[model samples]
Target: MDNAPNRTLLDLQALEDILQQGAVRTLFQPIYDISKQSILGFEALSRGISGTSLEFPERLFCIASEQGKLSELELLCREKAIARFVEQDLPGKLFINVSPNTLLDPSHPKGETLHLVEKYGLSANRVVIEVTEQDKVDDGFLLLKTIEHYRQLGFSIAIDDLGAGYSGLKQWSELRPDFVKVDRYFIDYCDQSIVKKEFLKSIIELAKVTKTSVIAEGIERLEELTLLEKLGIVHAQGFLLAKPARQPPRALEASQVTQLNLRSQSNHNEMSMSVGCLAQIEDAIGQSTRCKDAHKRFEQNKSLMSLAVINAKQQPVGLLHRDQLTEVFAAPYGHALYAKKSVVELMDKQPLVVDENAKLDVVSQQITEQEFDIRRHIIVTRDLKYLGLAPLRDILKHITEEKIRHAQHANPLTMLPGNVAINEAIEQRLRRQNTFSLAYVDLNHFKQFNDLYGYASGDSVIKLLADVTVQVCDQSSCFVGHIGGDDFMVVFDGDDAERLCHQIINQFELQSKAFFTSEHVEAGGYWATNREGQKQFVPLLTLSIGLVRPDLESCNNSHQVAALATDAKKEAKRYRNSYLFVCNRRKPAAPIVRIKTTVHECSV
Candidate 1:
């Protein structure tokens, strides 16, 4: 207690020394662009000197504000950040956090940031001025004017800690910053909180309306990051991606990149049948090509309906329809009149250009909304560069074929994929030599339940099982298929197969009670006549899940996998209650006999 005052004096002196000597340590945290799977930029964070009272940024900034050196401290920090950023040759823009009060401070030096960046030979365009929203703005107009000044100087503006401050939405609307960082509170456990997920959705929708990019910060878990990606949030910043460091990672770790790609591929497989499948590599003509030359090429290729017109950057700019050109040539003295004119003069500039990865159904809807002619061709692009052309007929044909195939392969009762699709899924994984676990699920005593309770009640129980399985399996990378009757199959891509199996069994056990009567519930089962016409007490409906991790090196086809799963299911059915049988033998024995298995009984 006697040395408290002296310690305070020493801390104040340290703050003063830091401000004067500019001893701030600048660290950078990477902001990831999910779509590009690369670092979008780095947010420059300032830390106090090591082994000091203000080692963390929060205390350091608070002390600076209390000592009336906020503006000076911020300027010095920005200078250090800019110098270090340039020294390290970091990629993408540098995001520097500046408090609104600091920008509004009368003592704040105008054009000092621009001068510092210029001094370091860095472009102001590559620097993002993050307007920290923690400080209350008494004068909104002044802050807006200051932000506009930064914008005029070619500095992109961003609102930091949105939803954690007052007047955040107002600042977003008034200043219209180029980016907005969502507060970490909302990102925490977003996967488990519906309110947080909805809030994020609203923010993303509003950002789309304002044309501002949203960056989710403080993502400390992969689940949170995965949910953000699913919500179409393009940019994310968090420790899960890369923590702040003097030398931050310029690119995502290879494993993280693979996960991102796999998630993207899995999502595409689940949601979208990409239009790229229907795109044909058609020849494209340059914008400067003569109309006569285009006509000759069209005539040379008799089947060509239209030619995509591209710019020097290989981006689709327009389309030249054969019918339109033919009509012009058939006109009186039209060919002679327009012989030397460039195709750009007559090309349709508003032709629909769709990304190669666009969903087939979405593309179909776009075609319908545009009222495109059936013979018209649409330009397809990959990353904004022209890749091929997709005819309207081909898109429609593919959609029709897909609908038919889906109907044929989908089970009529639950609409889940049937055996054929399940076999194909297993075979595809086997061909890729990917290690995955296959869970074969069946209902024990299902036949007795169907007889005791009517077939209608039985169908309801089957659907209930399907719903529970799908709900649990949808949380991870797994494929759920209805293998006729009460039997189901699941192919999980990761090692969490046993956990997922338990979840499915637990959920089904809880939900299946609803299908039983009061007496049946009390007794845990009902009396039923066996197939031999003998009375017996039937146990309650329970699940038997057989989980097997197939060895890709030895598992040859889906048939062998099916045999293993079937044997494992037999082992699980030995228990009368909900149970899981994990097969220890990865490879099946000769003649596909029963293999060694471990039984895990699930408590109701």
Candidate 2:
């Protein structure tokens, strides 16, 4: 035990030697942009010599802090990280960690970081000063001033480990940083905990309001990454995407990129149908044409209400109303006075112009926001080049038709899409020849529960299940539909279908426990009468999910997909607990006498 003092002395000496010799090694971990499927930047992490007492970062930094050399060590790490980053020709921004206490220290040198970056030929604009929340700040005003100093030098600022240390929301609000990274604790198992999910949602919403970009750090599992993506988090840093290394990949793996692209395409397909279908092909006059010429064309074609004025590039510049021209021509000697002038003088230059791919509802909103006369005609374009015109009357008609159709095919209880809409979703996927998974979800022993509880309670349970499914699947590029009564369907466009299925089952089990009485829950079930009027022990409510990956070549329609999913669901019901049965058969054929499947049982 007496040798412990000697060991400590030796460790301190080793740390000193490391600092003097400049033996810090820098490894970069990538921060990914999910929406673009590209690398946004990298966070530089520092380490010491391998196989030594000071090899780990935590020990090295702790010893440095004890030795009153924290600022020196941090400066050395920053220099080395910047040098290595430039030497390796890394891409995007470089995030270097700096403590607040060090910045507030009187002895700490200012402008050193800027000098090193300039010496290494790197731009200050590419470096982000990540203020770590490891130590308390005695003076918040000085720290803010120091941060402002760094900002004036063209350095971006970021707050690290938010919600895990002092001055969390306070620091965030005061700094108004360009980036804020949520701590790892909130990100772990976010999919399983509703509280954590709500916390993240609130953080995201706050970031949106503050106009601050959020980055989720310490992501280690695919489930965590998937949930973060669903919550609208675009920037991420973690082991699942890529580990810290001296040399890292410039782009994601091909398979991962393909999956992201597929999800994006699926989302695009599900967007409201474009307003291009309502476009009416009509003749447009050039901006340089005479007003008299436009008036003559309007007179010849009595149906023409307006003429779109285009420039040399075929882009819409304005709109000329027929009534305006007639009023001008009706004035005393107006035709002789203004007939020779250019049409640009009489055109409405601020007419409503929208892209052909814009949503009908969005275009309607834009039209309604305009003046009464200006809202009469909308100029539609493809890539800024005028294609045709969309009249207000046509837009209103199309929207009315869509509302009627949607009302007819929507489920009354859950307000989810019904059979006709489900079939249409499946057929759309089939037509695109895209490979996707279909899951037919059914409640187990629901009739028995309905018999014991009143219909109101039963309806509550069904709605609860629907709510859980929607909440879990929201923004996941997956479609949810209610077939009827207690049966529902989900279409998955990504590869994480099985994991998502488990989430749904787990969430349903936890939320459904409220419907049962305490005595019934402890007993594991309740005494109920079966359909044959015989007394039996019916288990609590559970879910049965039948999943099938449909083959684009063999499965030609939604009917075939539905049939295969139904068969798979039968196999899932055989298990007593909540379960998932994945069908191996891709083709739609006669029901097999012997089934081939894989089953996963989920414990409540």
Candidate 3:
């Protein structure tokens, strides 16, 4: 039993010696940007010295803490990792694990790591200090101060293993890290677990509110990846993505991309339709017309089921039905009783009237609300003037068709027009010979967030963005379409394309910041593993919009507009922040004029 104490001392001595010699090895794991299907960065994981019982990372850290040498050991780990990171000529940020206790060690000077970065010809901007979340942070003030000091020197902070340790939310709120790595617990079975899905969604919501970004750790299944992609998480890491390696890879495996794309296509094909377009209008009859005259018209037009009875000003007053008229006239001596009476005497006063522009689904709901008074033929009007009648059967049929069309042509997630609808809408605009602007919208770093969160959460972000787009654009003058994930198209009649795009980008910037975690806002970016499994810093999500003016005479179709606007979008994305690029490709013979305007630059 006395020998046990001596053995403990020997183990402590070994740990101290290892720390002094800086014998730890660093292995990197890649974090992927799911949307781009590319690597974002790599996390540097520390391993114990070779041929030692402390060879395992968890054991090495635990033993070091037990030996009261955690501060020294962690420092050594950081130094060695940074040195190797520089030695290998890595292309991304280096995520170095840091305990709050290590930063509290007054013996270690502040900015020591910053100086080390300079020694290796690297800037502090390339280093992301991953704060361990397992430990309780008692001295919150001290922790915040230390992190703030590091921030001043350009070192981004990440809260690691969120939802696994004590004070996770507290630490996040206080420190406001650049990245919050969701613990693997919530990610497990998130695809099937409604509870876990809700929890992840809340975390992502919290991050968005704080303007921080999340990193989903330990993703292993294709189902998980598929779910996360739908949730709109852009940053992810797991064995499925890439195991920790000595060098990072540049892109996702081609096979993985192909598989994911096929799955996406399959999922898209499964979407069902809802609602439909406006019903066709039928004619109205004059209220002053005699019953005999109206009866003659109904007899002449066998298909005329009902007609709107209108007043002198062409406003509908009542509905005259052929069946009701026939029933009253068919009665014994009915012609002698009503042959000279006006059509108003027999017309139904309470008729179901709706505007011509109302959606078929909304109109159906209105009709359903009035269970007793469903007009056999609904009266349709333009500007309160009688236009036509839409039969009940036709309305029902249109709604069903609309639902089917929505499923086939609208974005499954946003329920907005997809490529098929967008193409058709653009062609119609061109066919009308109307001057309009076509804006192509894209979300920057959206892939990174989608990789970090699950698809369920990522989808909320996309939906929110869609909502904002729909809200800002006038439905009367503008048509919005979801051009697949994180990309949209808006067609605007009149010269308000620039104004509308600015509003969209501006409104999106305000709403999008809330989607990120606090830490991401503080550092102006998020940390992820690049292709070679090296940590890289990706900027927060921003919008890049490209606008092009459509010429009725010169442009052949919507494809030409998309092609021209794509050039502008590329130029807009080249800037460090959100920007708008306008291309005047109206004249076929004239040179294209690109307008580079800084309408709204999201403060990074």
Candidate 4:
């Protein structure tokens, strides 16, 4: 009668028995190299037997900490995890979590983890001892020394869950870990949250200055990972990228990798805007060539504005302008006086030779800021080797064209991207096979409000709605489009789709009252004729957001996503007042069942 099958908490005796019996297990979660499109490493997560009080890893660790068996339990988990990591013949670095308290334990076996790794015949370099900050360490000096000792033994150090724990930055400053794992809380919807974006930005900047690498953890959305890539945080780990499993994946989603690369290419194209449309490599004159020979070559190419003088090593030493050289040869006996001399003697010594990859804006600035007349032609080079030349006029023309193209595609009312850009964004996401939420936001009861208030007032309402959406969305990651009229589209490339739409609904409702008449505001409705010409009461201006998500395998193209999202939007319109309807379609692998949906109604 006293014997009970289950207990609320795992008994201390049971914990000891589990450890003695070697019942601990390990699962591996992959860390992705977004740029490389490959598995960079795997983080080893410890697990306990199911149907037991120690089934939960967190509970197991907590009980161990309370019982002063933290070091013993951690070491056991590490041993079991690493043994399996070797047994599975897993590829990539093995990231093992170790509490700082356990790291500084006086009785803790020093270099035991290292020995375990060596015992498995795995290189110490492949093992990254992640110093977890869950338990705060009081003595910084001891912790630093302990981390350093591991470093000297050839183990790379990492700080886990950077922003989640106390003194994460302090440890980062003191220990200067080889890598810092950003906390999941900040990464959840980082693409749609400015606060998160700015916070991660500062961390990335800090990493750059300190020469430490950053690993964005808990990236569960394509948009979040996309933003991380744009910010140059290439190393990442999350459920969206890959989930924890018994074995590492052969590779990540090829489409997602392609999408990240496409974005990088787009950024490269933007940077090239500084260089204009000028050729990457232009013709140049060798310094060893005689002045007369250089003159003959310039004469051969009548369109040449200037020629770059390069030495034996292909390094640019000077510039020879057609106008100045022509002026020189025009003088009486000038050709005879300088015919035999090397081009270096006649060429302008202070030449402006820029790297081929230099931005056009930077090159233009250099040209305008120079004391000498460097406006003739800019000599471009790659790794000091002559590449090409660009005239000032060509750069200016390209810049103007780029600006004109952007302006042409922008929406006239809100100045946001119109249909073309939105299509391109959708296609780009589809190509990468990244999961992103597409929300179709259309105003509710807009025809009645527009008909009553006139087009001018309606335009004002549309602009206000645009302002609210832009204000709530993370401008860095979210794409807002003015599709046309009262129908707007927002593609959330991050995980904060639900929260973002609700915020938009909340803001629009609170602000729409200002545009209503006193009587309409008091009554909360306006009398309007239906399509049949019968009089009916219509609600005030409110927004209906229909959200849909299409992953790579589920959706073949942007059109499919648009169609599904439109369907979701129609579903949302069925409800009165402000409403949000999300399409929660499951993947094909899941057993097909009755379709389920979630509707959120906002009465305000």
Candidate that would win on TM-score: 1
The candidate 2 region of ten consecutive residues with least summed lDDT is: 261-270
By TM-score, rank the candidates, best first: 1, 2, 3, 4
**Candidate 4: RMSD over Cα atoms?**
18.9
Which is better, 1 or 3, measured by TM-score?
1
* Model 3's TM-score against the true structure: 0.47
Ten residues in a row with the worst lDDT in model 4?
262-271
lDDT of 2 by residue, 1-604 (tens): 5898887797798888888899898999999877656677899999898888788888888888888899999999999999998798787779999989889888899889988876776656568899986579999999999998887666788999988899999999899787999999899888899998998999999988776789999988788888888799989999878899989777788676544431332332143468888889998998679999999999999999999988765767678899999999999998998799988778865567777987787677656544345346888888657899888888877877876776788889998878987888899899988778999999998999998888998999999988887776653567888999999999998787887888899999888989999999899899998778899998899999999999999998899999999999999999999999999999998656977898999999
lDDT of 1 by residue, 426-524 (tens): 988898788899999999889888877889999999999988988787556788899999999999997778988999999998889998998998999
Q: What clash count goes with each model?
A: 0, 0, 60, 11
Residue range with the least summed lDDT across 10 consecutive positions in model 3:
262-271
Looking at model 1, the pairs that clash are none
How well does model 1 score by local distance difference test?
Answer: 0.85
Candidate 1 ranges with C-alpha deviation above 4 Å: 1-22, 29-42, 51-95, 101-129, 136-157, 163-166, 176-415, 418-421, 451-459, 474-476, 531-533, 588-604
